[model samples]
Target chain A: DAGITQSPRHKVTETGTPVTLRCHQTENHRYMYWYRQDPGHGLRLIHYSYGVKDTDKGEVSDGYSVSRSKTEDFLLTLESATSSQTSVYFCAISSGVWQAKPNTFGSGTRLTVV
Target chain B: EDQVTQSPEALRLQEGESSSLNCSYTVSGLRGLFWYRQDPGKGPEFLFTLYSAGEEKEKERLKATITKKESFLHITAPKPEDSATYLCAVLASGSRLTFGEGTQLTVNP
Candidate 1:
């Protein structure tokens, strides 16, 4: 298993409320990514960070924001959560380019917005 | 836009049965193809990485092979422990990976 951890393994919240998920890695990988998994949708990347404070948007970045202040921590924030945002969120890390090296993933966070 | 598609959303196999899962993809510049296995309530675990067409990789009873447009994950003499969702993804030149919906495999003892 990879040294990756996602906090609040399971969470339930009301719609229109602020929600934040945390991903911490001990591997000191250079790349970290936040993705959401839904039924029939597979895994969709919301955001990614190549280095400290260097981030980029993924295909499903709308209504979500991420920040990576240090090498080990990457945070994903949903300013105002919606029912549509309810999904299983996963965090992945890679020591080198993802295409060259397989990404190690954290257990995951199951969030529900009602 | 790069896309990945997996067929037969779910599969059922008896223990010792051999089978394969398919992943078809289209990417601008192919960099690599990846296979991951996920048990219920757990994140995906990396399985294999195929770089070019005709490339093959193996681990235990699992084998992954790739071609120009698709990849296949073959399992031999599967066991109950092999039950899981198998995910396929393609990493293009930009380091972004596009994933398939996955094939849920159930091996019964």
Candidate 2:
């Protein structure tokens, strides 16, 4: 919802395989973020992009990378998926400076690494 | 480091039961505090934003209040449809939003 879309709603991959999740936004928001939801950990930010080509790591950046080649798209890549990385991933967009404004999140992509 | 901690990992209530969820936070240069609701498979939906201590906002049966150290989400006269996980997050001096382990709320009719 909120003009944000994440592809491949569900996926199961072998451990150590590379995986990429895509986030697309029609809202033209200037900020986009990738986060993972796990039991007990809550939502942990993986990466965020302030603008196209301007991406930065977040709290839980290990084993994760993100890229934004266009304003509407942000991609998160797990170089080598692990069972520990299996969780629901959410994409968020913020339309404010430094993102003080509330973020709009996508429906989430459930990724399972076997 | 900016951090947020929500209490009562899970809650269950009968229809029309009133309750509150707590989110205690510690952050330098507090920017804002936000509340969100998430269903089983969906992304979190924004509920309210509190910019400063003592500020409060309300929507439907939910009222969110904030202070310097913590925030409270009060649910009044809850219905079965109100069941969902409520998340609290805070934005401080940096660009990242730190979130707390949400409180899963179940409203039984």
Candidate 3:
């Protein structure tokens, strides 16, 4: 266990509503990432945080935003949820070193935008 | 651009049978290739990492082998419990991981 936890194992929100998903890690790793898994697209990166305040956009990060105010928590928010934003979100943590190690993931959050 | 492609979007095998899954990647400055297993409603679990070509890793009945352009995950006498989606990812000169559409393996008992 990498000591990672994701909130709201399942959620249903109306389109145009705002939704925020939380990813908490017990391990003091320096790297945290958020990804969405869809049936035909596989796993696509949304955003990632390297430190408390260091974040970078991913390929599919146009409609999503992320914040990491502290070391153990990373929050992903969709300002206005859309049906296309519905996906299974996953949280991952990794020990940032020269050569990156494999990341450990949390139980995913399945969000449905209805 | 880093690209990863996995073949046979889905595979069905009888229990105790052995098979292989393929992952081909195109990237510059290849840093690492990773393998993961994911259940129906769960997140991906890390299985192995191959940094260099010719590097191989084994755990239980799964063996992952890597080369310059591709990687292969070989299963030896797989059981029903091993049925799950297998994902392949590669990290190129950056911190991002480019993933291939996973292979859903169904091992029937």
Tell how far residue A102 is off in model 3, in angstroms: 4.8
Candidate 3: residue pairs that collide? none
Model 2: fnat (fraction of native contacts): 0.75
Query: Model 3, residue B76: displacement in angstroms?
Result: 0.4
Ranking by lDDT: 2, 1, 3
Candidate 3: segments with Cα more than 4 A from true spot:
A98-102
Each prediction's DockQ? 0.71, 0.75, 0.63
For candidate 1, the per-residue lDDT at A61 reads 96
- Per lDDT, the best of the predicted structures is 2
Clashing residue pairs, backbone N/CA/C < 3 A, model 2: none
Residue range A1-114, candidate 3, lDDT tens digits: 459999989999999999999999999999989999998886888998889999989789988999999999999999999999989999888897632643788899999999
Tell me the lDDT of candidate 2: 0.92
True contacts kept of each: 0.78, 0.75, 0.62
In candidate 3, what are the lDDT values of residues B4-99, reduced to their tens digit? 999889999999999999999999999899999999888899999999999999999999999999999999999999999999999999757888
Can you rank all candidates by DockQ, best first? 2, 1, 3
Question: Lowest-scoring 10 consecutive residues by lDDT in candidate 2 chain A?
Answer: A95-104
**CAPRI level of candidate 1:** medium
Kindly list the per-residue Cα lDDT of model 2 for residues A61-114, writing each as its tens digit.
Answer: 999999999999999999999999999999999998766644689999999999
